[model samples]
Target: MVTLQLRQLTVPPGHRVILHNINWQEFEAILTELGDHRATRLAYSQGTLEMRMPLPKHEVAKVIIGDLVKILLEELEIDSESFGSTTFKREDMNFGVEPDDSFYIQNHAQMIGKERIDLKVDPPPDLVIEVDVTSKTQLDAYEALQVPELWRYEAGKLQINVFQDDKYVESDISPNFPNLPIIEAIPTFVEQSRTIGRSAALRAFRNWVRDTKNI
Candidate 1:
């Protein structure tokens, strides 16, 4: 993790000071005050005071994951009404963090009162996906959110972590949807720049499903 440096500069008696050191806590407080502003997507972290922003790679990966989830919902006949990116916040331990993608299923979708949500609510999303483009480890974030399941796509593979007994356990495959071929083909998706639009990938997945049923 990189630490931001704040410097103080002295000026002549008659001149105005060019720079001054600002306390990290005070900086975070200013960000909190601007929470109502719609233009602000992310604020500084309370602990590190690090300014966070969504990257382009994050957006691309999110689109692919969202599309896959939509396809899965249709194939599995699951009732899902909403899907969104890292625009909502989850409050835990006096800090709020957002995941890359989140979705509500079944009756949980009925609780949404508007097109956007900013506050924490009961029963988080059924699934949360994160595109780990940053070097910072996500273990702490996962622990804080207390979400039931999380999927991370990083270094050409998909890692599924299921929350159990206040901790996350990793597995080679997703337990939430056992039949999905997300894990098997994630490497190919990561390798090809235009992989998401490849018809062969979907055809391969369909073949895998058929083979599983015949066995």
Candidate 2:
């Protein structure tokens, strides 16, 4: 039998590798080995584990969307704590995922001084953002964790999914920000970032959010 160490494997950019039948202990060991400094993204469900290396465009989009969300919260005077791609997992449920970005809006106070997320005791993020520049998103982990809301950006569009009755259903409105047209407006700003520069696009988005208050 041929054996390969996790370190021996290299997932190229814009690609993903899947390991099937990975037991819980093995998953923990692999995560420990990978450490917190890596660039690869991960999602584990049941006995399957997936590792993906995001494209450069994917990196830009997720960060801009995260910035937009924070802008929205600030403009509205809504307190929030953003955790960019912090790994979230539950051993009892056998599910784990690292989102593109996450935020604790309603539960920000509870997470004020927390060093790390322990899903068994801590609440799942109020909102999770995923930018699918390459692979399709695996929703099982988010559902298993009962994340209240999700925003998925794909093919230059944003789709909001709300957790309902133990499952995810597409929703036009984000419970966190129901007043704005997130679906139509977010993609525009994200696209603008490519042409006008990130800072300019973010500034435009911030201005737009502030303008919404006047109406």
Candidate with the greatest lDDT versus the true structure: 2
lDDT of 2 at 5: 97
Which portions of model 1 miss their true places by more than 4 Å? 1-46, 86-92, 112-121, 190-215
Q: Find the 10 residues in a row with the least total lDDT in model 1.
A: 10-19
Q: How accurate is candidate 1 locally (lDDT)?
A: 0.56
Candidate 1 to native Cα RMSD, angstroms: 8.5
Model 2 over residues 1-215: C-alpha lDDT tens digits?
A: 78789889999999999999899999999999999999999899999999999999899898899999989999999998888899999999999999999999999999998889999999999999999989988898999999999999999989999999999999988999999989888999999999999999999999998888678
